[model samples]
Target chain A: MPYRYLEDIATADVAFEAWGKDLGELFAEAADATTNVMVEGLASIKRKETIDIELRNPELDILLYNFLNELVYLKDARRLLLRAYDITVEKEWPDFRLKAKVSGEAIDHARHRLKADVKAVTLHRLSVRETPEGWKATVVLDI
Target chain B: MRAQLAVPESIKKISDTVWEIPASYKPGMLVPARIYATEKLLKEMDAGVFDQVTNVACLPGIVNYALCMPDGHWGYGFPIGGVAAFDAERGVISPGGIGFDINCGMRLVLTNLTYEEVKPRLHELVDSLFYRIPTGVGSTGFIKLSFSEFEELVEQGSRWCLKKGLAWPEDLELTEERGCFAGADASKVSRKAVERGFDQVGTLGSGNHYCEIQVARPENIFDGNTARAFGFTVPDQVAVMFHCGSRGFGHQVATDYLQVFLDVMERKYGIKTLDRELACAPFNSPEGQAYFAAMKCAVNMAFANRQVILHRIREVFSNVFKKSPEALGMSMAYDVTHNTAKLEDHTINGRRTRLLVHRKGSTRAFGPGMEGIPERYRETGQPVIIGGSMETGSYLMAGLSTGAGAFYSTAHGSGRTMSRHQAKRTYRGEKLKRDMEARGIYVRSDTWGGLAEEAGAAYKNIDEVVEATELAGLSKRVVRLLPIGNIKG
Candidate 1:
């Protein structure tokens, strides 16, 4: 796993940090972390369905923030537990565009071991930064 | 491990239960920060509370002081239990101060039965409730609506329930804002928020949200007169209390506005906040007016959500006891919001002024004779429900005139002392459930891990938090409630 839960950050909610050698890997790890918070086992969420998502933002951090919230919105609106893959990010002079495919199955309580219901991704200590090794992002979820 | 931020040396004790950090503690602070807590609670507070509360003091147009209730804990933008009253004309409205779960609140309903009568069938009663009232993530409601109908429902709030025969006339009277917040323009809300919340009207969203069946013991009644006024006449009165909010609808509303405010707060307006989460817009600005209107839609949505849930509760009790809802004496005592920013009248520096008060993880405990309190509770003050951990107990309190200093705000719940990860590591949900059952409390949870994260030991001692509120003259304790049955989400 490229992401680890930060136990000491949020006293009532869940917080985690993810890292990767590139922005695509960093976004994927963060997406997985967000999904894992709501469902116990990642493998349990079989990829029976898939959706294509395209988003554009001038700022890289806001792009990641919006991407994570989109996943949350899908869970509530479509009842799908999704994980991102085939990720790609392109910086077009004034904006950054992200296009990816998210796959998972509709929520089945008997089959999936559910956990906390994440409300949204928060801006509290929210960050996406380029490190010497790669890229890193920290997120705090409102549960 | 996160290192604790040491208490600032400039902090001064104002009273046994009140502490103050002067404006000189930080630059650009509009007012001092006031914290209501005992010495022990003050010391036990997470370092984030101090940093966040002080950061709130620095926001533009804050009045008097930035206040935090005794149950304050570390949260995103404003510390949990944070309260700030801003000038309606000059101040700014930030989504962080109200929280993502717009109008996440508590509702207390009274019943005619006693604990002895309920004990024998508690399991059946709880199971029925857990099944009837959907729980956990991705759970939808029984009532379905089209996109346009959902828009109308958010605009009408709980009044929609009355038209559908889902709520009694008295339920609205007992609810805050009469179950409908004025200025809610459905047009201001986004289509995505409507889709997320339309089917979540009666759901109990996971993570600290629950619908519990509690009993008020004779020994726990502190103010018999006030307790009776709130309809706790039975010797071991049974009451149903639930904590929930607007669900995904409110989260989307908050998320949408947060980005809007972040975009315009500094560029369009000359406002700069220390924390990005505290991004805000001037109250009189176009962005601010739009967000406020949209926020009220979520507020109304939440009131409708709880109203529907209350109806389900009445249905479950009626079926279990083999009687009509009215025959079973199922009546709502009160419903109070914990997360909201409303325009209210308050005396600021001896002048009565209308202010937009933001309470995040706090409750409005309007005292005797205050406007908006129901006529039945006019003399005794508004009823405030403080939910505790399922394993411990909860409280029913009354607002005090003396709470005017904090804009009539008080603690909402037993604030968490440990993080969810820490609690999960310390206790097993299955074992905790078994232990609670052995102690005469029946609980049904959606997931064991979710149950483990909310262990009583993870939260502060409820008794002490209630004591601090009373000691600080914020609210008066009326009765303590111990859980007999609960449905955890």
Candidate 2:
């Protein structure tokens, strides 16, 4: 399950309904509901940090905006307070490969919580699907 | 994406600073359709910005009114707070009325250190302004230039950053057109806009550029009475606000002048358009004076890319306040521009003329003893800069002569209200960066899907859209700032 809020002007809103026995746990629960909409006790941090994400696109909505602009350039230039514990996908030929693992707490605010600075990931109204209950995507963020 | 056009039962409310629309609602218009909003911001518009300001009062030398300010939206073909002028000896000059980000502006510096000496190194001055500023979307900068010095920086902007020592020489007497724009013409630009502006000079591109760090809100510094008419004075001091434009060589000179005004619209003037994205030409065409001299060389390459990002923000406040970027006083409290197209002069039914205008996403303003501003702001008139996202709050208005049918436009930001795919299916870039760091705002970005597509509930209420563009006279407020730290791109 992945869900987030705030919509109108400087927007953000995400939804997930995953049955993920494929498409890599619905793209790792939609990148952990898009980094839990900017860090909020991703189940109390203990994933012990793994970080390794790679993306190339042909079009899965520009491979989900190059996998969320590489988790927003590792949370705004490497202050890294992550989520999305795992994702492995490969669809070569013009490209699409992502391998991810993330943890948190380097942007400590009595322990991770900072939000919205998003500035691009638009080709306006982008979408992705592989339905019958498995993968779904709808992206837009130019905050 | 469901508005096949509707809002105009011949509008009429003319008494809250106007709102007309008529000319029988739509038959190749030619005048009548004024807006300026505030009946609660005209019930937050979106009948496709009143069908693109009545399809811009059916173009072809339009004059009188097509206005629309209270920060209107639905852009691309004029409607981001649109404005139109046209009549330099019989009108027309649309590159969608100057938008593809040509002179996308805003600049305010002020400093003298307060906020208790910059709140114990505000996170090492926002991580040294996010590692010496260089922002998103194919971003690149470290001063590169060179293509005959980016053609003398599109022809001397910010006086070529104070002759390359990079700023300070009284920051070009507080910018505006002084940052260059004496009708720029770097040989009417284009070698693919000088190879996409050779290495993006001092970049901060991407949609809605930024760079903030403000304060002055102790009830608007006791109600701006002590910005001491510009020299400011304490009250948590520190200011730096930013917003960018004219990047990617102003989107390849508005896509090479909207394909040279659609190949000279109807073979040298037979004009016809209900929207080929409003591609226009006439105003004594030669491709509209070479798209107004390549839109004044994308407004002097966005005033020399914000005078080299204000010389890398005075070298990050002269290395985090150790002082010496002229004793860190910083300077330049004016540098407006809200998208381009100039010529100006005004007066209209009292005669004067010399129009052209444009404005897209608006700004000019003018007023108080005008002489086209800049003589230390000719008695406080043109400053205007609006920008308000990154957790809302921004204003600093000034222009007032009832803005003469908008040659003195206004409203430039705090418009959109969701639609970056409805703010990425409704928020959560880490819970909007942990609720803008628990309201002390400290964002830095390259992406969290571009920080959840900038979530301050994705805009509007820039104090009720600059109080309905200063109660429709189109510009008046004065000071209000607020943000504390940001750096998005």
Docking class of 1: high
lDDT of 1 by residue, A91-134 (tens): 98799899999999989999988889989999888899999999
Residue-by-residue lDDT tens digits, candidate 2, B1-489: 332234466689978856888877889889887878776666667666787788888998888888878778766566777888888878888877777668888888888777778777877887788778877644567987667888877777778778878887777777776777776677776675677666777887655688888877556743364255665676667788898877766666676667567667877788887765577888686778877877777787787788788788888878877787668778878888887878877887888978888888788888778886777667767777788887887877778777776677888888876766566558867778778878877777766666676777777778888877777776777678888788886
B405-470: candidate 1 lDDT, tens digit per residue: 899999999999999999999999999999999999999999988899889999999999999999
lDDT of each: 0.93, 0.71
- Over 4 Å off, model 1: B1-5
DockQ of each: 0.90, 0.05
| TM-score, every prediction | 0.99, 0.32
The DockQ leader among the candidates is: 1
Candidate chain B TM-scores, in order: 0.99, 0.38
Q: At residue B102, what lDDT does model 2 achieve? A: 80
Best-matching candidate per lDDT: 1
